[model samples]
Target chain A: MDLTDRPDLAYDVFAKACPSRGTLEHVTGRWGALTLGALAEGSLRFNELRRRVEGVSEKMLSQTLHALERDGLVHREAQPTNPPRVDYELTPLGHEVAGRLLTLIHFLEGRMDEVLGARERYDTARGGR
Target chain B: MDLTDRPDLAYDVFAKACPSRGTLEHVTGRWGALTLGALAEGSLRFNELRRRVEGVSEKMLSQTLHALERDGLVHREAQPTNPPRVDYELTPLGHEVAGRLLTLIHFLEGRMDEVLGARERYDTARGGR
Candidate 1:
């Protein structure tokens, strides 16, 4: 079964104490969204992920990857060499979330014109904030 | 057309300069996610939204709703009266994005057990961080 298609489990995101909130934060974080989207295309070396994610600091990149890895949404593999080679890929679960996230990003990107128009109207109505 | 089903729009979220990045940030923010999800069921009053989204401060909730409204993802209707009641609901575009986001949240919440297990394994291997 695809990791993203779990139908038998449930929790209320609205609950203050639900563990799902932390997971949501990790899955939908600013960098987290981009990282998963990029990786959804395929696995990449550390530098490749950093490059694809654009403007992500090395520290932030590693932290994001580490958190995803810890949550089982991402898998990190190390190849022993003169210098260790590390590669990151989505687990089946990661792909599921990434696919949906990519769709949302695409949708938002497509609607930029509308969003910008609304922003202009809002600002105008508010007499410029 | 269902706003969530846009196939003709595209943008590289990987690029740092994409305006969609800003939109994505607003849509997927911590409080933003819960707010959108709550509003998806139906239009809600300010206090109703506050109650459903638990753990959100009044300032943060208002800020999130304003951003969502500005982005054209949500509709805010004010019934001028003694107290001027305001109700929030998803726009077509908002419904599309919120639908996907809610799915992801459901997915993540469903898999909390896996995430916790993974975290335990990760910590064990790291000798406890």
Candidate 2:
């Protein structure tokens, strides 16, 4: 079914066949999470963002950024200059989502200690120690 | 590098090359998200859970539950009964994480309207209209 057909219908992430799943995959992707977190600090050029987020291939970086850009979560600014310069920043909606995303990151950080301890206990219990 | 070696080191989801990325993938898998959301309500038998979560095959459900169980996030209880009956519930740790997971689901639900509107606006802007 076309989600667009139901313009009045609200989008639920939990829906089995919702296209939002693709959006979630894009936003929560390996590079996407890092990109979002990096951009959360402020806007950055494509190269700058690539450098800030370690272990990302140029192709993946460009692709992720494009996906985010297409979704309207990211705004891309291009400057006509020598060698070209571009910047990426969050949209208003992006800012709100990023705020919640940061909340998830913070929540994970707060529980890191406990999760680590549990991992150790788990390893020992499973005879992996 | 072995994350197990650094037992004291906390796991960050954003950290590059971190094993926790694997955990996140498992918990946030296509099936994983659905499984967690389904189990949030209460414990369920394996068959029951599989049925409750639509569009999931037996293989994926088994794999996702196994991963959760291994990570100490889910407690699997097998009852010695005819034809074998099993129940799955969140551990104390699982309860904490699942609470946050539910919060995410709820947050998405509340913002479903704005997201749909954004999607429509995005489609129009992108000439997908």
Candidate 3:
């Protein structure tokens, strides 16, 4: 079903047939999360996205942007310039989604200490790490 | 570097060598996300987890749990009884991370129309769906 056109519909992630499942994958994939987090502050070009996301290959970055764009979370603009300037900016929906992902990421980063402790204890319990 | 012992140690997700990057993958992988989301509400058995997570195979469900457990996000309890009973529950840290993932998931599920619209437009721009 054309879900994008109808913003009022609800899609459950738990359901195997839900299209949102695919959308979630696209949004939260390794590079996708980083891409949105990087764009949260402002727009960036293809090369700029590559640099900001750090360690992402050009092929993956391009793929991530294409998926995000297809999901309506990001907008791609091409400008007439010597090098054909292209920049990606978050759409309203993109901004909202990125903010949520960023919140999760920040929480994970902040709680690294707890995570470390858990891992340490976990490892030590099994056998010395 | 025993990062788990020193929670204060900074692990950049952007850096290739950082462990948090791998942790991120484990926590947000296709099965991982759903598994965490499932446990956030309450505890579940192996069969229940397999059910709640939709199409996850037994091998994948166990693998996801194992990774999450290694990361200190899930706790497996073994109950001695006539039948060996095992249940999985979220750790405190797991609770926090799962909440964050849930928020992002809810947002995606709520925005089905926007995603569907993007796909529809995307598909139509290429040719009718």
Candidate 4:
């Protein structure tokens, strides 16, 4: 599936009407990225996910999960146990996406000093904006 | 820098207060992602970029460029020709980031059929939402 060589994809995200754009948004959206990153480590329950993702509100986390699940990047399992256990984990496709995402993430984290220095220089040049 | 093995990076994006999270948002935000991806092919004038990115407004594109520039991921070159010329291109760091972004993008574009199929199954299970 070499997209670069395929003209039949009909999914150029650069085009406004492509559904790929929407899926891209779901994968890269603020909460969605973090949620996927957290799940990449392992499956987690609802509350566990909320805690791992830091500042996501319950509503937002739920919504994010639903979106990911609908896109087939996430799988949700509910157990009819005493307290009704539910857990979420990445699908194989989700793992691949998360791996690429984490590569970018870790790269940025490793280069924060350069980024911070650039910010300082930009601000100083802008008369401390 | 092997972020997985480094404890001193001190820039965990999963933490709400980490500045890396802000950088991640700038790189992956709707317009930001599109803008960087567009520039990865080559430098482009402002109007050229807007046309390539397909739905970005003048104001949003300007704002997105400023943010990327401030973050050191974009280089904005202004020329003093008669009508004046401004071009946008990825910095070396920006190129690296954009490469990773494109990988994810092309992957998504290639798999959109699976994604759409998932969406259809999901909507059907929900009684056609």
Interface RMSD of each: 1.3, 2.9, 1.2, 0.6
lDDT of 2 by residue, B22-53 (tens): 66665566776667777887999898888777
Best by lDDT: 4
Fnat, 2 decimals, each candidate: 0.85, 0.23, 0.70, 0.83
Cα displacement (angstroms), candidate 2, residue B110, comes to 3.5
Q: Relative to the unseen true structure, what is the C-alpha lDDT of residue A61 in candidate 1, on a scale of 0 to 100?
A: 93
Higher-ranked by DockQ: 2 or 4:
4
TM-score per model for chain B alone?
A: 0.88, 0.86, 0.91, 0.93
Q: Candidate 4's residue-wise lDDT over A1-129, tens digit each?
A: 886586666688999988999989999999989999999999999999999999999999999999999999999999889879998999999999999889888888888888999999999998997
- Candidate ranking (DockQ, best to worst): 4, 3, 1, 2
Report per-candidate TM-score of chain A alone: 0.88, 0.87, 0.90, 0.92
TM-score of each predicted structure versus truth: 0.90, 0.79, 0.90, 0.94
User: So what's the TM-score on candidate 3?
Assistant: 0.90
lDDT of 2 by residue, A11-58 (tens): 555566765666666666677767887898899998788888877899
State the weakest 10-residue window (summed lDDT) of model 1 chain A: A1-10
Q: Give stretches of model 4 more than 4 Å off.
A: A1-9, B1-8
Candidate-wise lDDT, in order: 0.87, 0.73, 0.88, 0.93
Select the stronger candidate by TM-score from 3 and 4: 4
- Candidate that would win on TM-score: 4
Better of 1 and 4 by TM-score: 4
- Per-residue lDDT over B50-116 for candidate 1, one digit per residue giving the tens place of the 0 to 100 score: 9999999999999999999888888999988887899899999899999988878877877788888
